[model samples]
Target: MARSGNEQVSYRRAPNFLTANEPEKRLDIRLSYKSFRALEEQALTLYGISPVEYSATDSRVTIYTAPTALHGYSAVNLQQAISFAVYNILVQHQKQELFERIVAVGESTYSSVNDQGRRSTKTPDAGLSYYYDGGTVLTIIMEVGASEGYTHLNADILLWMNEFHCRTAILFYNKECPKFKFPGNADTYSINDRPALEHTWFGTLDTAVLEVFKRDQNTDTCKMVVQGGSLDIGLTIGDVLPPNEDAIQDIRGERVHLRINFVRNMLASGSHDTAVSRFNHFIGED
Candidate 1:
């Protein structure tokens, strides 16, 4: 029946029997190991991305953010640009062996078993993995952040060392964050007795560069370079990012470039020494 515009509306409706007791009947489904593995494989095939966490004992599957946020920065894009620049430099130097040996993986999950006999996973911001003796090893793990909360990051690095084992780990942060404290200090705790390389980026108009040299007594030398510049979306890695305010539209895009060089000497055999260096050249654009 039709009613006039001024008629009062009825506020009654039939109860929905389907949803009345649905919450009580909801099942807490847990995945099995085989099923979880199968699902993970399926996901890898479809998405080509690593699973966040795949536990076999408890058969638990957990997903986490792949490329973690960096507060006010484009962490993922910066990571990619750095990787691309490094790759290009490696290729240019004709260091095919080292080039193929070191692979850059961004936010890839790695599985491990802890001392508590629990399966765990870690996703570093970026990892430089080296392959040797039919096994893959992480050469360095890099963590970029806007803050100085190193507790979790240090714990994860230690976990990676114990589980997968690596040569070293590095931490990069904005200058505004708290300074990194060295191990054995009164205010800091050690992470497996290994000291991580900590580098800070100052976002001032003046560019800053840091160089780290690692010498293994008399056998080899490794050098790492870290350079900071102002934000410029028009320029990428290997392109000189200007430090002038006029070059940047968004301040959040401010970035740091990293490069590594390795040199090996055959002094024992009286042979010539070989050196391979990678550098990211920056050319300012108008």
Candidate 2:
């Protein structure tokens, strides 16, 4: 799976069903643990990184980097870490059903038409897609990293909302100063009789905490607790749940509850030893 920047790597051999040349055609392919591991290794080699744990789908692959990696804190790693932490918390709280319904997929491609009726596809950093009635609905699409500017992020989010009809889109960054709104709901509104869409801003990692915790202090505990807020953005999973649960509703028509905490150190950058040591402590490693 070696690839140069200009090279197009083919996945023709990637389980026949997963290979689709048509934009509208969809395929479902399952991989065994060994097959998935092989794919991950191939992706890592393609990225020229050391062998590390990773995840992949039919279209995209993600290599999980440690907080102490020489590259420093990565938004990709942060996105996966936070998603998994939320997933685990849901499971621990006996909300397995909600957990099953809410799937956090990384780098998955989504296809839709833009406002101009042009077909387009985008691979969001992470997506919390919900399953209902034998189909999938993207509840939230998340963007990470500082490489992308706010304008670009917003344009992409607008596409996801206008084209894919996603309920919410969030951008997560570290390093950049916070300059976005807190958790708020936006609906399609008319301005000068022209339709305008609104998207929620979860802000930078620090701002996200401030919105949820209302404090600026750091603690050695290294875990940040997130709770739901009353905003039109979506439904509240529960009082102690993540604030972005406005669109999530259980099969029983009840508002699902969620609660999660993530290692703060993993989202911050510093010396490799300090980052790794903090990560180890958070995970209870000796």
Estimated TM-score per prediction? Answer: 0.34, 0.41
Clashes of 2: 7
Worst 10 residues of 2 by lDDT: 211-220
lDDT of 1 by residue, 172-276 (tens): 433222321111221231233222223121122121111111111221222233333322222221122212313223432333343232111111111110000
lDDT (tens digit, per residue) of candidate 2 on 1-286: 0111111232334423222222111111123224445654665555454564321221232222222231133434544554555465566556656566667667677776657886666667665666656776666666543422344445555656566666555554343233222112112222232211132221233433211111111211112333453112122233223334443333222322223223344444432333334233222211
Give the winner by TM-score.
Answer: 2
TM-score of 1: 0.34
Supply every candidate's count of residue pairs whose N, Cα or C atoms clash at under 3 angstroms: 2, 7
Model 2 segments beyond 4 Å from truth?
Answer: 1-95, 114-117, 176-235, 238-263, 269-286
Task: Note the Cα lDDT for every prediction shown.
Answer: 0.33, 0.39
